[model samples]
Target chain A: MSEQIVSDSVSAIKCTNCAAPLNILGGGRVSTVTCEYCHSVLDLNDNYAVLSKFEKVKRPLGPFKIGMRGNIKGVEWTIIGWVTYKTIEFSDEEWNEFFLYSPTHGYAWLVYEDGKISLSMKVRDFDLFSWKVKKPKTLFYKKGHYILDDESYMFYIDYVEGELNWVAKFGDKFTCWDYNGVGYRSLSIEKNINELEVFHTTKLNKKDIYSAFNLEYSSKSKTRKDETFSDDDESPSVFNINKIFFIMPLLLLILAFSSLFYSKTVYDTSYRTNQKENFSIDSSAFLTSIKISVSGVGTANNKLSLYKGDEKIFYIDKQKVFFIKKDIGKSWVSNAIAVTIYLKLDKGRYHFIGEKNPNQSITTVKIEQQVIRTNYLIYALILFVFLLSIPYFKERE
Target chain B: MTDGFTVEKSINCPQCGDTLPLYFKHVKLVQCLSCKSTIFLENEATRLAGDSSVLAPEISLIHLNVPFGYEHKSYLPLGKIRYSYGRGFWEEWWLKDSEGNEYWLSIDEGDFVLEQKVDSRYSRELFNTLNVGQVTFDNLIVTETGMATCEGFEGALPKTVTKGDTYLYTHLSGKDASLTTLELGKDGVETYLGKWISPFDIKKVG
Candidate 1:
């Protein structure tokens, strides 16, 4: 990766304690300079006065050196400084913060905690103070809703090595609230003594980190060190399923309405007969089948049959009866019953014949023939609804 | 030493005149416990008063004791430095072999990176015009995370450095577990190419 510093030229400065040739890589923003040779912490603003002497903390050296440069997000960043911060309550719980610098973008932070690396940038436009004051459970920004994941206090600054942009002291306390979104995006609200700053962080994969820094990539060392605080209920697949689920019902309505255009009346006829009546009608060659329906108010047995000459093609029987019944606590009651029958016939010329009993009179009889139409859209809609529900239930599962 | 290596010599601190031990010829900085003064080893005969920064010992589960064997070789921890930028910090430990060769072991969170310095140089204009995402450097494609400002420092370093320094950091990866970090500092650009080593690679010596 191309290594580039913000300044066009280099400014060499001697370490106050060691007098070693020390170059200010950060340009004007660097306030303290730790001597590379003697480990003397010098204040850049005050003639390189020794701020604090750094004792050698015997730990494993990281792969990156202070002057090592890598390209991250297409921006060439130099690893200038690093600090180790620990949880106040749990002294053993510590995380490393690497300060990355570029000429175009001033500063970014790569936080490593429990094997998980996250890149965070200061959110300048966010008004964290206003939201922190309100203490809302959820925060809305840009178009995403973020829920408060956790709130804690930073109690300890375990170690500080490289030059830091901020004046951070050991044992400084601040309230930090983390807000988590659906994916790897997160927002951190840190409320200091009198100020609140928001930072936007994105979880990074170790492979990507290696790629970003151009480090030697190793899958074995890329194990997840910490369990991320993720919203389990928010799965991308489930969200997509829900979005598709909503559109299915609308498609079903469209299918139902389309079936209306397919309906065509092939035959329409109504007839009344008190006695046995015989008639014949030729079926249309364009129609596949015919539907016949008969209804009457009568107390007689009636039989309707269609025959091609002597061969019976289709038949329907309508029987009605009158009866009287005696109840224990009621008077004798009489009731008359009516019946209706429907028949589907094939496309052919047929003789229509009706048989009735003379003992009981038939009040009225109506018979109608219409084309047998199938609304495939309604059937398709039923099948579509069934198919769409599969994802809905699977998502719930 | 785990790999049949031995310490060459021990010298006195140049500033405080205290006993300063040497494990490798390339050990740049040493801190004296007697007078709390740092000494910079300029050469075999020249020693200068070295300025230093101190950080509270990090509380960690992993302890350093013996030489770590990696890729059929052994490396002993020589020095460590803590750095801060903005509101964050990280640690880099310097390691050396019996052959006077130097390497850096960077530990942040649980991520471990083993890197060796490169002699290649790159232009500042190349980085200035580079866009975010992926870029090709030294025939390797790397992703740019972001730039950072130099904040503070502690412990010893491999190269000459001041307190407030900034750089453009980029990373490259091969098909394997090897990675390369390019540090674009004010003086020039340097490449440190290495791979992520497992925790088991660091072995305790008898």
Candidate 2:
């Protein structure tokens, strides 16, 4: 794999238990190498002897397969190990932990739980704090602040596969304290049989993880590394000059094409109703927002309502809505005044009808449909245009 | 520091009477490459300490008299001291930069910490009374404290380190990956300040 760190020392070795071929990529400090095919833990210090075996247990499924390599930041690491753990309180709650190994940088972990993945690295440079001490709501580490998630929970290891830095058993228990930091970063302290291992984790999106392992590309991940983590060398700005240069023209270009598929009119008509019947506007083709503009000169007490077949979305009561008289210089209506009501609607086809009063005056209404996305696109284009030109006008000599 | 150092080419092993090459002039001890006897050099007098049990060549990345570098600075490794703690052993390489500034590159497992002994005026009496996890008076947090035994030595060292000599050492962590090591030995407490270096940064050169 392109993500694998190539070294002269790394070579494929056979599992001592089942003689299954395994590729070990870690350093000399690695204590155990678990065979993925036979589920046997091999102790490296003792001539690769089989320490334990789980012949009957089934291996837990994870997103990335063993031996797959991924690049985190700039360093490439191989997924050498995987451990599946279940919470003690809830048997169904489980998480799969994937161990990453870089020959020079040591070990790291990637955890998958509840459809979310997080890349974790062991925390060094520990200071004055421990689980024995009461955890504050917010705590500082390195340069970031993390908020405590909960009291903590205990979990037991259910299954294991592949090589690990330490030995693994079937039922080893560990207590975990998780804290959420800003952006996609978080802190977790895992207390096991011997030591407390704290990890600084950055939540990984689908795009990064997939691309690193050479999987099919996904563009849906919204997390940008620059937005979450800030370096001391880079000064934060409210607007990016390069993005402004790229986005203004792009948004306007998108706005011009939005009429074809998404933002165009799906339904538009003017209706004059004097009878006790409903006017239907079918918008089954589109699945976005539609603007409904209703206007009428009321003859008596009446009720106007917009609906989707049987479901009445909202109703305008004549008792509450009063038409105000206006003078337009040359023309003015004294008895009958036209009241215009504009409604921004979301979702399915609509049925507009004055169902309450039969003798209601002839209400004239125009229904125009333009998805709400076009409005934001137009606004974004104007904003980027203004932002981009401001820098050019600055630093006048 | 090797400010006024005059390079001593070779020295006779006190026990075996065999010649061993010296890279740095401020050599307090030397291990004969042939005889394997650790010889302590003080003025003109030399004493045979014992057999030097060196680590396997595969375990260490550096070699005596071999030059290595990072960034703009280059260093010549003169000697090394291997210390064994409860868990594992760590090696401290005695190196001299191009400008003759001596440094101790401590590599424990894979964690590398390059430190240089501070001047006498920089020492603090308050540093003597620090325990593990206790913050020092200088606001540095004492991260680790343990007894480390001198396993062996190779080449030329700046100080005399006898095999099986045990000393209590305390590691204090400071800001920006800065580290302060206090070695409480039979002589006294000696402190060295340096930063934690990424192992990828240190590369073996000619």
Candidate 3:
């Protein structure tokens, strides 16, 4: 491929097999370049010879793209490559590894796994007095003691792209031993046929990584269903169930206040032996129905006549409605009788008159307006609370 | 063993006939001050080698004849040799600590390893069969095995390192991040025991 020798920042190197422009960001140390356009792995050390070709590979996801310049720690690095891998023991497990390059610091790795991002660098000063090969129960690194997380495992390369410092193919495999330590730090021992490298990794905060790349700061992290969180980087979750504990009670209080505001007394009057009372119904969304109650004793034949602007709607005669007499407390003796009438009145004034017979005994009369006759406010609150708990309990488990 | 250094002299370069002042101890090879040609000492005779090639010097942390601190101890670099491999190159600096002890500090990119020559009983047959990542009977893991050619030289060296000489080397890692490096050339296999040093620990001594 013919190209111009411009500055180090610009590259015109093209893929030999596909003729796609391959940027040489890794400089003279890069051994391979996988053409992102054609999925052809080209050996950079051997004049870009095609070494491997990936078929039917899907592009990986996440917030990283190639050639993004960002500062990690103190050194500025340009993302030169990206690779996707799946664990051989757990085929469903997958992650993306980005190769970062700095001229003075050489190459490093940034791994995105389980909604978390971590920086990985080669470590040769690992404290070894606390370690064994097969079943290392503990590891000491960066002065922190770490325990082996289960056991060592192997992984296979599922996809490859851009430039790498070594020759790698689509199906190349490697064995790795991982140990999680304190302070969001982890150490891994990676071994293949050609090299054995130990890496020290520290989990990066989302805010740091996003701001370094000039990205919008999103606090949520993507996690697997069975994944857990650590203390240092907090957590990256889709929804926080703890928020429901704060917001649900405030919402319930507002509904209860609305229910109370709807049940109100628009008009009230009393019956004194023989008298007539007048009331008005303006009619609103909250006050739609009007009710009248006649209170008396001994099943009197007392009655009240209701009218709207001289038009008689009906009469509410005293019925056998009795309140359980607390006056006796031994049995439900009828001490007072009340007859109620619910009327859907239009926008007009109304009047009522009650006539007491010579043998009739009428005590008092009351009238009220209501939006609904039966107050289902308590039942509605119970249903609302039950509906909100489903997601809360599912997230907790 | 000169705890304090001895008398130094100047040698005339055979290629350019220029006088070169020698300040380093046990000089086996030196570069002329004017011609930049590599010169070697064959017993009492001095011979001229090829022109010394210079690696990119802007990124190097240590300078020749300058004192640096490592692990709270001071050391001065007296010699440097650069070797180029297939992918990249590395450098080995000869250092003498304040207590008069000497070491070999190798730097590849940002990684540093400090070494010192050790007496060994391993035969040539055993060294030939070692490969990268192969564990030996002594439980030492061979981490790297490669061939590199001499690219440049400066100051003084104890071993003959004329420009453009190729050699094979192997690195074995043992307990506590300790390692042993073997350089096999016409001088046979020379073994050195060492450990990886955190580059941040090396600072310019006041």
For lDDT, the strongest prediction is: 3
What lDDT tens digits, residue by residue, belong to model 2 across residues A304-396?
566667776655443443222222132212333444443455545666565323333444444444444455557777777786655444412
With a 3 Å backbone cut-off (N, CA, C), the pairs that clash in candidate 3 are A221-A236
| Model 2 residue B114 distance off true place after TM-score fit, in angstroms | 5.3
**Candidates 1 and 3 compared by TM-score, better number:** 3
Per-residue CA lDDT of candidate 1, range A1-397, in tens? 3333344334678887878887666534667766656767788777878877666554323444566566665556666677777677787777787877654455677877666667777654454435645878778654455677756557456556666656655455666877765445678888677456777776666666666666676544433543443223333333544565667767767645643453344334444453434443444322223333334444335555556667765554532222112111321122334333334434455555656554344334443344323355467666877886653454334
Q: Over the stretch B56-152, how does candidate 2's per-residue lDDT look in tens digits?
A: 5634556677677777577888888888764347789998887779999987655778899985333445545777667766777777887889888
Q: What does candidate 3's lDDT look like per residue over A84-200, in tens digits? A: 989998888999899887765667888887667888888787744235454467755655656676668999899888888787877788988787654466788887776667888
Pick by lDDT: 2 or 3, better one: 3
Q: Against the true structure, whose DockQ is highest?
A: 3
* 2 against 3, candidate with superior DockQ: 3
lDDT of 2 at B174: 75
Write one digit per residue (lDDT tens) for candidate 3, span B1-206. Answer: 12333326667889889887665546788777677778887766788765575556646678877787887888877788988886578889988777668799998876789999998656677767997768888888788888879887887777777668898888988877788988878877788999887665677676
Which candidate leads in TM-score? 3
**Given candidate 2, what's the lDDT at residue B1?**
24
Q: Candidate order by TM-score, highest to lowest?
A: 3, 2, 1
Clashing pairs in 2: none
Residue A373, candidate 1: alpha-carbon lDDT: 31
TM-score of chain B of 3: 0.85
